[model samples]
Target: MTAPVDIERARFNMIEQQIRPWDVLDLDVLGLLNEVKREEFVPPAHKALAFVDMEIPLLPDTDEALKNGHCMLPPKVEARLLQDLAPKAHEKVLEVGAGSGYMAALLASRAQRVITLELHPELARMARENLQQAGIRNVEVREADGSKGLAAEGPFDAILLSGSVHEVPQALLQQLKVGGRLAAIVGDLPVMRATFVTRTGEAGWETRQPWDIAAPRLAGFPEASRFHF
Candidate 1:
């Protein structure tokens, strides 16, 4: 009896109402949000809740993350962080968690190339498919633990951590170009803040704390992660 949903209007409202009110008003960033369909990246079952202001499940428990019920963050948060990253034309951007490939797609729209890391192989494969479907040619999805960072793809122009960290790994800081910026949400739930660290020079990185928000924890990065003991 329910009507078939209108996906395009939902995407428009999601951008104008939920994400924009969260202080994500940059035209370029907003345009990217409009261009990328979050619903398309969502799993078939969760497609309906794609525009909702909460996390959505990607898989049903074939992985460790599914056992934990850790879903993707709200669209507004992604928009805000992407705005802070400010990736430029012809720059290489690195993303730690591929998730649904939403962030990677966003980066592909602005950057020359995106080297993204993913812990879950299923997620990585799905992301690759989504990117292909979306016609995003610049994103390369890989299966790897982000705790180690991407050593082989070092010296990137921009780095983005797809989830929150209690503290960013010192190793990740070393991977950026002298002028590149790394954007990530840092801290625990209910009080985390998104930060941007710009590599000012050798042995020095300028940091900025922008948003006091919360996102799912990055799978790897035990060095920057909190102590269980």
Candidate 2:
């Protein structure tokens, strides 16, 4: 078992080395990264990988054949997404794919309130437990398919897809307030871009692809149709 001091050192190194190098320079975001104990959110079986620069599986045994495996995004990816989205203290945020609720915890620290949706019931329960243990009170973890976004409680200031999607569904964009921003990773395997969609007007939106990174697809999202012509 690693000592507490060692775990703290690893978390510091993760922020200074892995996350900072990826352009996540927001001081508040960095501070929140340190405030939240990532190891607690990580599965006990993989606790050693809490600060490692790779995705950490949330489940003890994830089926390889599963279409949407439950896992936490790499520390850098999560940090970068947070920095890019820039959730404000008074803003309401919506997060899709609450694996361990670590990301939701981060968002809740910055936003007024956060509503995260998870497809797996066990994962959803785990997320709620983790957030509660972490003393995060502004985030809610709901077990549901989040591909379509939560409309009834939406019109949020910011939205984030914690996992990759083949395409950002129009329904999600519509849930964003007129000036809200949404961040998502869009594309197929081998190549994917981190995209930001900002609602400019009642029906106008602008998109920008800032970087490339791949993540497991969020379950229940639509897959692009293949053409064999």
Best by lDDT: 2
- List model 1 lDDT by residue over 41-138, tens digit each: 98887888988887776787535554342457788888888888989998999999888898899988999999998888888998999999988898
How many pairs of residues in model 2 come into backbone collision? 0
Q: Which tens-of-lDDT digit does each residue in 1-229 have in candidate 2? A: 5458988999999999999999999899999998888998998988999999987878766564134558999999999999999999999999999999999999999999999999999899999999999889999999999998899998999999998999999999999999999999999999999999999999999999999999888999999999777
Best by TM-score: 2
Reference-based lDDT, each prediction: 0.84, 0.92
Off by over 4 Å in 1: 1-5, 62-70, 223-229
Query: What TM-score would every model get versus the actual structure?
Result: 0.91, 0.96
lDDT of prediction 1: 0.84
